[model samples]
Target: MLSIAITGANSGIGLRAAQALATAGHHVLALCRDPDRGRAALADINAHATHPAGLIEADLSIPDSIKAAADQITHTVGHLDVLINNAAVFDQTVREPRFTADGHELFWATNHLGPFLLTAHLSPLLAAADRPRVINVASKGLLSMPRIRIRFDQLDDPSWYTPTRAYYHAKLAQVMTTLSLAEKAEGHLETTCVRVPAVRLDPDRVAAMPRLLRTLYAPKNRMAVPAERLGETYARLATRAGSLPGPYVDENLRPVRAPASAYDRAARERLWSLSQTATGDPAWAW
Candidate 1:
């Protein structure tokens, strides 16, 4: 069975992907931020899956936690067939400029830098697999941003930040990073970014939002694809044989040509270099 690990597996797309893979009889590692929640998710997956699923507690927003999770995976699984960097946060209403333990902006750190470091740390394990693939979950919201560009200086600038802007920048970074990884891996590993369609939020989570924000999101969520459909797409990327998908793909697993800016070689290289600076890990390679 293919061994797969999914971050943010306690809920949403990650959880559903783990369940789908487990049901398909692949060995699944469901990584969650909370131990209790991870175990609960594992139990739910076990109930539906023919093959057993497991849990690993990991807070991707923190580098130390990511390293610890990687260490545990190496000790336990040895090799990973697929790694889905699916965990992300969209706290649009968080008015204050929050920072991660790493001192980076919360959205940027969680959505981009965390995955970059996690993938870097886990590269060796991924290489050990026969057909390793890295799948990054992205969003279409990026297209709506006006003149969207990677402003390294503005990443943590709360003055000009909005929840949507920060999130778009982070996802754009992810897309570019995926391209770099695909180029670096070449024949060794397959890396792809997916622009997953919006999925409805858990009601409790939505209820916690401001009434206006909740109302704004409710109709959009209603139009979103169910978690199960998105999960199936994620599993297909992992389990399917033959040629790998393009460097960028959509929710349907079809290849997508990322925007022209994302293909800029200079910007891409600069972003990688800045990532190294942010993480303070010169030896880390995508």
Candidate 2:
């Protein structure tokens, strides 16, 4: 069985993917931040899993939690066939910016910096796999923002924050990070970013949202695919035979180029450098 680890596996696409992968007989590490929710998800997955699944609790918004989880995975699993950096926060309905425990902006910390550090620390375990893959879940929403780049200076400044704008920038950062990893790992890793389409949320949850948010997200939901469908796509990418290099792939698994800014070599390197400092791991090469 392929040993795989998926972050944010407690709900939405991440949970669906974990269940699907487990039912397909892979040994999955369902990484989640909440203990109660994680155990519930574990029970749900184990119910039908061909191979038993396990859980790892770590809040991706905190660097220490991410580091500890990586260590746990290394000690427990030893080797990994796939690492899916699938956790993300989209505060589309929030009026103010939320900060992580480290005081970094919530969206940037959870969506970009945390995943970058987790993947870097776990590189050795991934290398042990005969043909390991790293799948980063990006967004098609990023394609619409042609002018927005990583605003390194204003990441923590909430005065100008808009939920969608913050989410867009964070997702773009993830795309660029995927490119950076693809370049640095070259022969050692096959990394790819998947542009997951918008997904329809549970009806009750959608109903609980504010009217403005409900209206704003409804159009996207109408076009949104089921979370499980996207989950299946993630599974295919993990175990697929051929290499899918780090070009961003659409929901259909066709390569789609991100905005030109994401491909800027200098910008990518700059982001990588800033990310090392932001994550507080100066010794992390590449």
Candidate 3:
């Protein structure tokens, strides 16, 4: 069975994916920011899993935490067949920008740079496996903001920061990174970016929302895709044999084109260079 690591596996899509993968008899590693939540998630996953799931406390927004988590994974699993960069912060309530300890915007750091560094740190472990694969997540919400572009110079600037803007911007970077990795690691490893559609939240979470939002979101929530469906999609991509349809795919595992910006080789290269610098230039196995 493949050894798979999924960030943000404590809840929502991540937790569901962990449950599905573990039930499939794969060794699933649930990487979460909170230890308590991780333990609870592990227990739940193990209850139905033939193979007990593992937990590694990891706060992706924090560079030190990501490093420590990678080290822990090395000791626990030795090698990883798949790494799913799924942890992301997208709080819609926050109207102001927040900064990480590293002086980067919270969304930019957590959603983009965090995954970049984590992948770099785990490159060796991934390369050691027989068929290494990396799955990056993007949002189908990007289709709504077709004009959105990566503000390279103002990525961390608070001037024009908005929750939705920051989120999609970072997601766009992730999509570009996936394509770049696929090209750079052509014969060495496999990489793909999944364009996630609007996923329905747990009923409890929706009930916890403010009354106005709860009312407004009810209709949309009904139309949102089920978390379990997307979770299985993630499991499939992690274990499916043969090459992927393309670097970018939809929830159905069908190939889909990325944003036009993702195709600009020069911009992607620039983002790569910036990401390396932001991440302290970890040794890339490719």
Listed in order, each prediction's TM-score against the native is 0.95, 0.94, 0.98
In TM-score terms, candidate 3 sits at 0.98
Note the Cα lDDT for every prediction shown. Answer: 0.85, 0.85, 0.92
TM-score (C-alpha, index-matched) for candidate 2: 0.94
List the candidate numbers ranked by TM-score, top first: 3, 1, 2
Output the lDDT of residue 91, model 1: 85
Q: On lDDT, who's better, 2 or 3?
A: 3
lDDT, candidate 2, 1-286, per-residue tens: 9999999898888888899999999999999999898999899889899989989988888888988999899888869999999988885667689887778888888888889889888888898888888899888777677787888778788987888877888889888988888888776788889988778775766887899888988987877898889888898888787877447998778888887788899999999998988888634323
Stretches off by above 4 angstroms in model 2 are 282-286
Report the poorest 10 consecutive residues by lDDT, candidate 2.
277-286
Please give the range of 10 consecutive residues that has the lowest summed lDDT in model 3.
144-153
Error of 2 at 41 (Å): 1.1
Candidate 1 runs further than 4 Å off: 282-286
Question: Which candidate number has the best TM-score?
Answer: 3
Candidate 1 lDDT tens digits, 165-199: 78888999999999888877767888888887678
Residue-wise C-alpha lDDT for candidate 3, range 8-117, written one tens digit per residue: 99888899999999999999989999899789889989999989988999998999999999999989887889999998988787789999888999999999999999
User: Pairs clashing in candidate 1?
Assistant: none
